[model samples]
Target: EEWMALRIGPVVNLPINHLAELSSKLDPDFPVVAVCNSAYRSSLAVGILQRQGFQNVASLAGGSQAWIDAGLPVYGTETQATVSAAPQRHVHLAERISAADLSRLMQDLPGTFDLVDIRPPQAFAEYALPGSRNAEIADLLSNPGYLTGAGPLVIVDRDGSLAMMIAGILSQKTQRPIKALQGGLD
Candidate 1:
């Protein structure tokens, strides 16, 4: 499973090839269902399959997380729902500089902004945007000046969760504006 295998091995060891093989075995004209824990992985897999000529693939939206949320029963480790409240900083800062505006700033300001990738080291190793430096959220929170640049900070992750969390934290800690990538790298 992605949860366990990815933690202890290289990404090349993932079953992406196996999934491709299985997807190939299916009839392109017929419907196919792909699912995973939170739908993130399954959505990515389905997109890959579609790109590889599987026209009838569909990803289960919300995946097993939604299933569990509906009070459905399943055998195995229980899926605990961890809910969090939105941070006010994120709401306020967006008015100052929208994510789209930030992209323009990347071009306009050049070295004005700093890019931070606050994902697990494994995920960071697999895929990272250009000019991004891997910085753990905890470390960044503790050492704010570590990645300081001339202007505001822009943060991203595999999903936008960590980036958003860091943005909120940094915003509360310092007066500098923070923004998380509109959508994650996926």
Candidate 2:
């Protein structure tokens, strides 16, 4: 029999991919302790948070596994509802559209599809392709019904990772044709 992984304690679980939303959700000076099964992603998260102007941030030296190994307090039960707060990895393969193809499609068939840009509002305001609409990942995931459009929905991001993950999740949840921009807008 396999056992589910347990959380260390009551911690604000945030996915590293959605760090863009952190600024809006957390104060820049809020103390943050990033943790994971291993310390690799935690360290990365700490660096990203620091770059985003987060004043006090740190990563667990060896992560939750280490904490468990040290016999630290933990709380969870099989009956406890599993939290789906963290973004799931792209299990379903999402279709990718090359930039050239996307450009051609935009020019050749206007209104045929919706280009949803999932980048931060500031970045989108700074620069975005024509005919693209800004959207939050949370909205896209929660209210997928709004995705109804003429054709396939194309997701765009700064580096395509989040877009790919979103596309995969959406593909599993909706009947709409989904695609992520290959290599992102970077």
TM-score for all models, in order of appearance = 0.44, 0.50
Candidate 1, pairs of clashing residues: none
Model 1: worst 10 consecutive residues (lDDT sum) = 5-14
lDDT of 2 at 150: 62
Runs of candidate 2 with Cα error greater than 4 angstroms are 1-93
Q: Write the per-residue lDDT of candidate 2 for residues 1-186, one digit (tens) a residue.
A: 101356777776677788757655888867888888888888999888888889899999998789889999976644556888879775545699999999999999998888899999999999999999999999988985745766999999999999999999888875667999999999
Candidate 2 collision pairs: none
Model 1, 63-171: lDDT tens digits are: 7677667776544533468664755334334213345776677777777778888888898899886678998777888995943555778888766776786787677
In candidate 1 the C-alpha lDDT for residue 92 amounts to 39
The per-residue C-alpha lDDT of model 2 at residue 28 equals: 81
Best by lDDT: 2
**Once superposed on the true structure, which residue ranges of model 1 sit more than 4 Å away at CA?**
1-102, 146-149
